[model samples]
Target chain A: MSRLPSVRSLVAALAFGGLGFAIPAVAEEPALEIVGMGSFHVGGRLAEVSGQPPRDIVFTPGAPPARIDPNGLYAVEQMYAQWFKPRTERGRVPILLWHGGGLSGVTYETTPDGREGWVNWFLRRGWTVYNSDAVERGRSGWASPDVWPAPALHLPVGNPFERFRIGQGEGSYSHDPAKRRVLPGNQFPTEAYDQFPRQLSPRWTTTDQPTIAAYIALVDKVCPCVIVFHSQAGQFGFRVAQARPDKVMALVAVEPSSVGDPARVDVLKAVPTLMLYGDFIEQDPRWPTIRRTGIGFAERIRAAGGHADVVDLPAAGIRGNSHMIMMDRNSSEVAQVIQTWLQQKGLWR
Target chain B: MSRLPSVRSLVAALAFGGLGFAIPAVAEEPALEIVGMGSFHVGGRLAEVSGQPPRDIVFTPGAPPARIDPNGLYAVEQMYAQWFKPRTERGRVPILLWHGGGLSGVTYETTPDGREGWVNWFLRRGWTVYNSDAVERGRSGWASPDVWPAPALHLPVGNPFERFRIGQGEGSYSHDPAKRRVLPGNQFPTEAYDQFPRQLSPRWTTTDQPTIAAYIALVDKVCPCVIVFHSQAGQFGFRVAQARPDKVMALVAVEPSSVGDPARVDVLKAVPTLMLYGDFIEQDPRWPTIRRTGIGFAERIRAAGGHADVVDLPAAGIRGNSHMIMMDRNSSEVAQVIQTWLQQKGLWR
Candidate 1:
């Protein structure tokens, strides 16, 4: 029998130093063409709680010249979503990406490090990508503090790096970059780590109820979609899947803080769910509990004969990944991994 | 003074139904251009150990027609590397990427899920990117089985998925994809999970010595370089830095399975190091000890007045990342984070 090339021949080939083996030419394929692109608003109801009309607020002396027309502000919480359709769609269903807390659809547009985000990456992969700004966030309208109890909460400057595990523990952030204590192998964009706090939007502690309703409405409008929920949107995404199993083809939760009622997860049996967690969760005092609950819920779903897969990024060797997996430097790699999972489930054509 | 927009105005502006706000037009910059591209071989001693000559073996009458040339192969284990130089050269030092066990430079090319990997991503960020197949791997010539103890070990089909945390556990992989028991939140490319086994190359357990020598020679050839190593290459990467700290600007180890002798970490004080660990590490039976040792080594390096950062990805909110972070879905995200760190350290101009 003719055996494999002997090691000696292999070395002989190497003896001819600097001669690069010709790379075989791969057949080039057409680039992904954007066949359709559009934006739309979903999930809003006009509230007649008051008969107040539009009024103008005039600035007083010493204040910079300003006039504000504050009308039916916060009367409706409409969520906005933009979509890009690939000319040749490879996925059987559209992907609806929901942002995490204190953020909006912009989460998937450009990374904090100023790189192309996952939306375009997914598009290039022949997917119909839908990026949504959930209710009270981003392009989505928020309820007025007068009506919806808006308590502006600003994240501490150092919190993102520390809490997100981009930097080391409490002493991680510093005015002097040289003194900053980052995780030795942190994958966070530390040079731009300070820029993150500026990106945070004011969040209200009591907006959960309305947010869920608006999210559900958006789901009703776009049924049979693959929902990718990030952070705070995690619970809402799971609830949507549970509420209308037929409407949600699958659920991909990216570091979801919570999920639907664990006792009633049987409803999720029909929807294949994939929960992905990024790095540094164990260090977060709050995430451990969240992780436990999420794990319990997933186990319940699986026990109920559903496809519930849990992905822990750190365990997978994708080290130093931050909470914002979508905007991460290696987001496309994560997206590719998710897409592969979708294909395995036959969700992707 | 005119203060920032109130939460009400934010909501009001958001309420203008269907009136999409004009996205700020960001000034477009010129695309990253590659100024030069080249390939080279480095580090192989001329072996006068044998005087064996070349010979051709003819097939027997019953055997299929074939003529095999068996000659002086494994005589040299020169490492091969290709580089792309960004026109702008934003980064001061070139980045050298080394792959893990049984893998080659391909690890940093296209990901397992077929996405643009960190190689091009780094180049776009204005850094010179060098992708190298270490000695005896890929374009680097393999030594003869006679000189090197080559073990014909075929990885059990299901093991990569399981051991690598792509699949759930020992029984996670199945011929029936549906039967696979992957970690619940795994971010591995499950759809293309099966493709991983086919990509694996047979590795020798006894190749460590030559591998280290070849790697050191490469370092000597390309001085003052930043080395990014993954898995099995981790220890070698560390040793190279220790042997010639002057030649290595920095070291980034992604989910290293092992590293150099912890006792000698003091020598690494001058070479800033980053050790990144991805998801599900605690679940791996052998990783805990490896992690402990690495952490200890890093501590020693830091105590010795060196910069050694240890990043646990899961803690950073990047969950479900796999061992193959270089090829993971968020590989670019991880790379961006590293680039930012390098910038902060004044390593990237």
Candidate 2:
């Protein structure tokens, strides 16, 4: 493990064909010739600009403080499973808790209330929980100072949507967070938030914000785990699912209310999603708007042809429910339901 | 407009690629030659079960009405813009109001006194105004049904990630009003909310969603009027800048937050972006957070070698202006600043 491991590069080799992205810099060593390409440094001041740096390629294990190329394609970073405890006792199937709106990944695992956190929820059931914060939302950071060029709208387009640069965070939510509401079934928790730029904000097109790829790479190299997404984080997890479908064996999405077009259910079809919704009646003007969104979300997922088993909390014999049932008293029961669901679905062997 | 326009034959070319998606059934009439895509069918239920029925697209001029895709991308739907009567007779440019987290496009436009709505704020000041609830929110009825092939990973090395079946709605929010999110900057006017799913929900992979050429085509056909945004919509606008840099003439952002990662900012370099924010001193705790993210975003744009005019509301004498000040009493001042900024920047003619 003392040598540079094989690094994934978005080799933009358009062979009238396909290559993810090109590495600009290359450093050679004995065993694995680490090629560096598509790397750049971010400048501190808005006025000061930096030059494009080459991407450094190294073997996976041997490198210390492994500098995963911040702008690498989602595929490279997605190879590993995401969980809370990257390093832990052996056999801890890392359970990464994805947070909902207004909450970070950390909060997903252990909320202000010491109830069953997303991480603890899975942890007690013999699973390691890895709590991740999408860029800007949590402690995790973003990409280069400048926005990277998005892929052309062509076949095998690499990150064609330029999502890699649009890290999900404020600079996003220009609306007052206290006031802004998350549509329960909202596919993107803050897709439109970036428009409300504060006095000092980056232009989405021009800024190269880091993506989950960096985090995914960091997590994969650091620990072993299973991915668990709560509300908002499910979007990130969805992207992760696409980036590395293999790394995530089974996905447990606790009511990941989708805001994006459910019509594009293409991405959500494959990932084994377990959607849990509280007993919130639809068309209830009295209920929270998000609750309505959540109810609709459950129905939409099922319609998309995904195996969405939406059972009423009471009917399923699950207890302790609310908008955020993770911290509810019935959390343990919810956990058991999840275990049962996964087992029934063969997610948990 | 009544004639069916010929487009690139990618639709026909798809057959050679062996795509599982069913090409949209197009009816060709030498007389009516209408080539229109599917819009959000308000109050329609997603059909359950998979059956290839004899499909027919009913192209009613006002049949579906301007609605939003339920995926939560852009806040503004076709109806919002259509119903919104911009004071075009007045000197004000139209401001499209896009919703952020808790608020819908209407939230920005609605006030306690019910006077100075976000659209009204722009309209009263000689500007047109448009706002809408994102897909799945408010009244715009659009059910996004995702359809795709079974995603079995690791097929052809050169083949991109497994292509999901084309789900229908507005399209990708970023591209189509369906799967895209309205930018915060775009929120002010001439916009769609972010998370307007073109086809897929964010709970899926951004990469996995279908391409945005169609939506980009639409935006290229529209959005030249005036652009303003708040939080989440800002991200959408940013993507637009990249997608169609030529479409935007001038951009004004109020409390434009960061686009999660600072690294994503290359697209805004050319577009004249006037980034404004409220006074952090008198604002909420999220104020400075907004600034931090905003500055991070701007910093990335600058790092990408783009120029952005940063206007601090407090420093400019408009103190006590909160993040959503664009909809506040002092909004006109912000608008004036935008006008002045754009004029100085040579955007406003």
Badly placed stretches (over 4 Å) of model 2 are A1-349, B1-80, B83-95, B142-218, B260-264, B280-287, B303-305, B346-349
Candidate 1 has what TM-score?
0.45
Task: For candidate 2, report its TM-score.
Answer: 0.31
Error of 1 at B327 (Å): 2.1
Write candidate 2's Cα lDDT for A31-101 as tens digits: 21101101111111111223434333221111111122222222111111123221222222445566553
Question: Can you give the TM-score per candidate against the true fold?
Answer: 0.45, 0.31
Tens-digit lDDT track of model 1 for A26-143: 2552254554444455666544334544332211111122222232212255566666677678878889888876655657765656665777667766788888766655445444
How well is each residue in B1-349 modelled by candidate 2, as lDDT tens digits? 1122112222232224321122223253111111110111111112222332322221111112112111222211111122233212342233445444223344453332223444544443344344443332222221212322221111111011011101111121222334333222221221321111111111111211121232233345445545666654555555556667667665666665434223456766876666776643222323355566666777677678876656665555555554456544555556555544443443322
For candidate 2, the iRMS in Å is: 26.0
DockQ per candidate, 2 decimals: 0.01, 0.01
Docking quality band of candidate 2, CAPRI definitions: incorrect
